[model samples]
Target: MTPLGVFFLSIGLAVLLGTARGSMRRLVLGGGLSLGVAFFAFPFSRALGFLSRDALDPTLLALVPVFPWLALVPVLGGLVWLLALRPQWAAWSGILGGGGLALLGLLAQAQPTQLVRLVPLYGLMEGVTAVGVGLGVFLLRPFQRGWWSLVLAVGLGGLAFSWLNTQGHLYLPKMVGYYKLLLPAPPGAEEKLVAEYNASLPEKNAVLKELGQPLLRPIASLRDLEGGLPQEAAEAGYRLLQPSQLQYGALAIFALSGLMLGGGLVLLRRPSLWEMGDPKAALILTGVLSTLLPAFEATEFKLQKLAKGWPFLVQFVDKAWPPNLANPEAGIFPLQSVLSEMLLTVEIALVGTFLAAVCAVPTSFLAARNLTRGSAPMRVVFAIMRAFYNVDRGVDTLILALVFVAAVGLGPFAGVLAMAIHSLADLGKLYSEAIENADRGPIEALEATGAAGVNVLRWAILPQVLPLFVSYTLYRFEINFRVSVVLGLVGAGGIGYFIKGAMDAGHYDQMIIGVIAIVVVVNLIDFASSWLRSRMV
Candidate 1:
């Protein structure tokens, strides 16, 4: 689609969405944002050498082989829905629609040759695609109007765009893939060349058998034929066909995206649906689309490449399976192996959670609002402690692992430190909340008896919150173990480190072993932790 066409299309889509949702604000927001995106993103992207005019264009099949009568079902259904609901028109519309269908069926049966000819697949697909779009939009249950509006608008725009222009295909459900692949267009001369060769192959092979020569190989594609075919085959007008792979480039992605989006437009037209939601959602959605559409161009997000690339992924999966538990390089038999690495990973998680819990138990009392109240100095400490927790939590553990890996060198020690530092903040926050929620009656009763502050806390707050602290610690231990696995990927030691080494050396079998170990150990640890937490807490 041309930039100008996209620009207008965006605005129209936004407006339609607003109308469907019954929100004027949505209409304005969607239209304005869509126009802004189309105006700035699409054209400038083209000018900046990000996309060509046809960059978004998926190859549209000009004609499709859907028998034209099949298209009539939904069209008639829609017409009946639109016109037959009225008290005055219901009977007449039903009669006319049903009789018209019956007559069309009779005509097709009478003249099967001409009446059954291929119709424009685009027209059939337009309704079918729109219906697919509607199904996707139907995902809303407790339907929020704002998000629904955004979806319907985009779907309407896509279904409309398929008619006016051809930008690349968005895979939905082979709905558009059907257009990409099965349209009624005849094979090009290049394709016909291969077809001709294959058609003649049986005859040639039979002759070869009679002459006591080797039989010709069956041709699946142009590549199957030998260099320039035999000289006789070439002279017989059977030069190697152009690669058929080129035809698949447009249809590469699955058509799920198209089915959902187009289906939405059809649903909106037919369903007389309305709901309330934030209109700003439409504006937000449009802004995102503006950015993402351009990003798709910049990133060249074509799924078609997968057609040629899927073999590599399949090959990797095949090699990676049946995890190798034994490693001869580590040691013979069961002396040292993945078992050692797995044990180290558990130690890292165990040590990190232990350290964090030890520190947090004492420090969290100062951070709790109830404990720090009634003293200016304690309040200051509370603010400082809370700020520290927030700052520490904000810094991700993996990033901390990278820093520690550089400073401490690559080992489980680095992973231990990263997990401990991060877990301290997490445990501190949970512990403080538990402390703040402790019952006040015991502390007051103890304090009234002239007990020291420390004694009051020991007798009252500690007893109340200790079980919760243990529960929280067990939870943190579970999380820390998982984090440690990731830390190993960054050279902070454990099974992640072993896995990374195996992957880098293309020992997928060994790598899969590490992955399986991590999974099995994590599930076991989680189950054990949950049981202990339930029992102790």
Candidate 2:
């Protein structure tokens, strides 16, 4: 899209944001951040690369490449600190940093150009030393308690900014492939190639000398070469593996993502320091915008990129339309085959949900923080159970399905086991929360009646959270069915497996039949679940 079109579109987005946020302040903030990134931050940092190639002053230009970290880092630190932190020390930071840079520039100008250029890496050494002092001084957090955290934060923040600077490639997600394409030749390959090329030149050039053709020059560095090599050089193990491609876009990305990470950290910790008394919604939105802008840039998320996928979709539809419900295997009726696979899928979901609910019912009582409050041993159990839930939940159902498929050797049983394990953690966590929120009045009343602990739990707690548990189990059953379809694609045996077989065999017509069966069964299950929930849950 053109710049002017993008500008109008951004305005429309700002207006939409204003409507969503229900305020004018957030609209202005969103617009500023969006427009500023488009016009200022992105363009400015990209232009910084031109400084290395500037012909304005030969001496300054020469020094610029020598100490990239030194020339730009401190000025960037000062500006970020001033904008984000708003500490008492921020103003002095800017002044002292700027003054020091001015002094250094003056010294370099006054000194002999020959001496400055010949000097062995003073800029690099000084920059490294300063960074070291900044990082190391923060380790005494114990000895330096009160106001020292502020000082330590300053030291620690420098490390964060430096990390953000070097890790530019992480934030440039789209350009990673481009960078891999730019990967240079391995060490000493160029030198070896040069050696081989020079050794063969005498014999190769004799023919050229005889024909009065241009004699090939001896290869010194691969930089001197272009596309393709001479016949003799090709015979000698020469490779054009060293890529010379450069992208200046990375300079812009690093600068913006660095500020986003550093500034977000500071603002998250001390929102009062943000501009205009830290309007709560606006501050949160600002942080979100800061995070998402980088992500959008990283992922190459242009609307135009999305448009490129539509042609493939249109072609697939043209091929796949008018569903073919013919027997895939040796089945008498083709439609019954689809129904059979879908019923198998539902069975996997049913078994998974029932097993998970059974395990979760007993486990959740032990995990409830409220029930375990008085006993130290029970509290420990509670912590361990909650931790187990977290760890189990962290492993995705698809990953668990893969593991089970490996163990059980491909069937609906593997899908059932995977869904059960994943569902147990999710249900246990939900059931525990429901138990925690159960009415305390009934438990206290039952305890006062000289009831045993087990009796109190059976009568009082179960009655309160039983409805919620049923509701949660029903919901898990719904999710597990959807998950079972995915499991089939991994050879776990369901309608998804049938669909995958169709797709792999290039039977788009048969695949559409499976897809249609899946959609109809899913809707029927949802309707049944809703009616059951109304009557029972």
Q: Which candidate is the best by lDDT?
A: 2
Q: Ten consecutive residues with minimal summed lDDT in candidate 1? A: 44-53
The residue-by-residue lDDT of candidate 1 on 375-409, one tens digit each, is 89999999999999999999999999999988989
lDDT of 2: 0.60
**TM-scores of all models?**
0.51, 0.61
Name the runs in model 2 displaced over 4 angstroms. 11-279, 297-306, 327-333
Q: What is the TM-score of candidate 2?
A: 0.61
**Per-model C-alpha lDDT, please?**
0.59, 0.60
lDDT digits (tens) for residues 1-537 of candidate 2:
322233334434434433443333322232224323332222211111112331111222223443343344334433533443343433333233323333343333233211111112223433444465555665545445746765775766666545544564477433322211111234675566668768888988999999999888876664455444444433332323211121222222232332333333333333333344323544565566556666776787778766988898888887788777665475535466678898999999999999999999999999999989888999999999999999999999999989988998899989999999999999999999999999899999999999999998899999889888988998899999999999999999999998898899877877888898888888988999888889987
